[model samples]
Target chain A: MTRRATWRRRISRMLLRCLPQLMPADKVDWATAMTREFDYIADDSAALAWTCGCVLTATKMRIIAMVASFTNTPHKNAITSVAVLVVTALAVTLMVVAPRTLTPAGGGMAEGGHVAFWLMYFWPVIMLISYAATTRRGHCLPSGFLLLSLICLYVMQIGTALAVGPAMDALFHAFGANVQAWDTTLKLALLVPPLLTVLQWLALNRLDRTLTVRSMRNDSFAA
Target chain B: MTRQRKASAQTVTVLVELANNSGQWLHGYAISTATGLKSGTLYPVLMRLKESGYLESRWEASPPAGRPPRHLYRITAAGLRYLAATDDDQVSTSAATR
Candidate 1:
């Protein structure tokens, strides 16, 4: 198979693996449709780009599913929520500190770099929002807005990264310099979304287990 | 599961598909494309429909390929009533008429 086709296939398989969590339906139909869409792309660049977008969209969907399920189950204890909050705080702190350690002496990040730094916190903010959306027992307005904005922001983030990537690469080449901090910063910026998602997946599984046990106990008592 | 929250546009779009198809079994991919719903949006809506007793699904055997069978779905009687009660002709009044 050609390189582009191979890339698309690999990404498609990875995304399909996550489909079962969000989709109750058999995964085969989604897989077939994803493959057809991938194979239909005529150009290599377009195919590769489409693959990236598909991965992001799928991951976002998976997180949203986790949030909904997590919210549906009433928390018998707040330990899980507290644990996630602590981890999120630490993550935010490390994200702020780690990139600075990579900076070349006397060299600093540009304005875009500053923006990216703040944006790296997007995952934490979304995590907080998800917690609020699911855990709270009140009107849904705040959580609803949070959900909508985060989705929009993530889509915009991916779009902006794709659009600015080539220009950033060209500019760096023009500088003809090895910038360690910039390199680390860019990598962290991209990593935030996926890292947050993995955290969500783990939290969901833990809470789900707790929920199941609680329900089982209630059932036994009822019997 | 009987969430009476007003159906979002995407949910209504799905209802339209289930309504139009009536007794016909529609696969997820077909619904996804026809309703312009993403996999993320489409799947959750499907689950809700099932939970609400508005839809039912069964596995349809696949081709010689080793992949798992596909999910075939159809709207239930309650689903038709939902469509009829909340019938928005803009989506497709035919769904209500049926």
Candidate 2:
């Protein structure tokens, strides 16, 4: 019913709809790797999407698998879905609270803005490493390491928020301002890279599809 | 009649079994054995059904007696509806065939 829930459902639906052609499980066995590799090298757009879908699906599966193991229930799908919805809600709340502030200017990168910046930059890497280390991929204990790192990071954020709340207001006053313009600027800077990356990916996919269609047409003409 | 026979004759009898056994958390191994499908074939079908939102699976922890883990699969609400519709169609076709 919340805006966040509505958007999450929308995005999930879009992702699922786009998934069938690109899902990695289309191949029945490991031996299909060679063909998959060749398809990738040939720069097929469909194959690229399939690769992306597979990796995304695998990462999601890993999250569910880990949750299931913890609960000792192979049927933790419903629970995992709830967790994802909660995470999405948290992300929306953070965005609303932060409200597009510019990254604060130089407390030698120890300011509240700097802390937020690092949190955004570093969390995905930790999530991915943990994902790779677990499930059928190999190297198990690294899963523990990944979870530890995440916990440590969350604890540090809590500590910083408590320690810096007063200091941030004081610093804003010292800069002769009542508003936090730096946080807004920093947010814009942080957001641009990912947005650009997504746009570039989509454009590339379109181009690849056009080229594939052209190639197929030429082949038919030659035949 | 012809269509009922075709549907009835389909491998694994998913309709009858599901119609009879709906709502139970069935084991993957049980389904495989009943259907006479190899693990490979059954697993992919299960995975596909899960992806399509027709079924669900959960891992049950090993019992305190220290057995290995097992996954239990169940038909979702959507799957139940699909099975019911298929059963209806089969009944109509069977009557026509008769």
Q: What CA root-mean-square deviation does each model show from the true structure? A: 14.6, 18.7
Which predicted model would earn the best DockQ?
1
Cα displacement (angstroms), candidate 2, residue A55, comes to 21
- Model 1 DockQ class: incorrect
Indicate the worst ten consecutive residues by lDDT in candidate 1 chain A. Answer: A22-31
Q: What is the interface RMSD of candidate 2, in Å?
A: 12.8
lDDT of model 2, residue A125: 69
Task: Please state the error at residue B56 of candidate 2 in Å.
Answer: 24
Model 1: how far residue A174 lies from native, Å: 47
What would the TM-score be for candidate 1 when compared with the true structure? 0.44
Local distance difference test scores for all models: 0.56, 0.45
lDDT of 1 at A76: 30
* Residues A1-223 of candidate 1: C-alpha lDDT, one tens digit per residue: 7886677767655664654344322232443444445444555555555445445555655566557656774563233443443444344534453434434446785334454466666755765566556534332222344345445544555444433334345345533454765575556556763576566646645444444445556777999
Q: What is the TM-score of each candidate against the true structure?
A: 0.44, 0.29
Quote the lDDT for A188 in model 1.
59
Check candidate 1 and list the clashing pairs.
Answer: none
Regions of model 1 farther than 4 Å from truth? A18-76, A79-223, B1-3, B62-67, B92-98
Counting only residues 3 or more apart in sequence or on different chains, how many pairs clash (N, Cα, C under 3 Å) in candidate 1?
A: 0
List ranges where model 2 is wrong by over 4 Å: A1-81, A84-110, A136-153, A160-163, A167-223, B1-92, B95-98
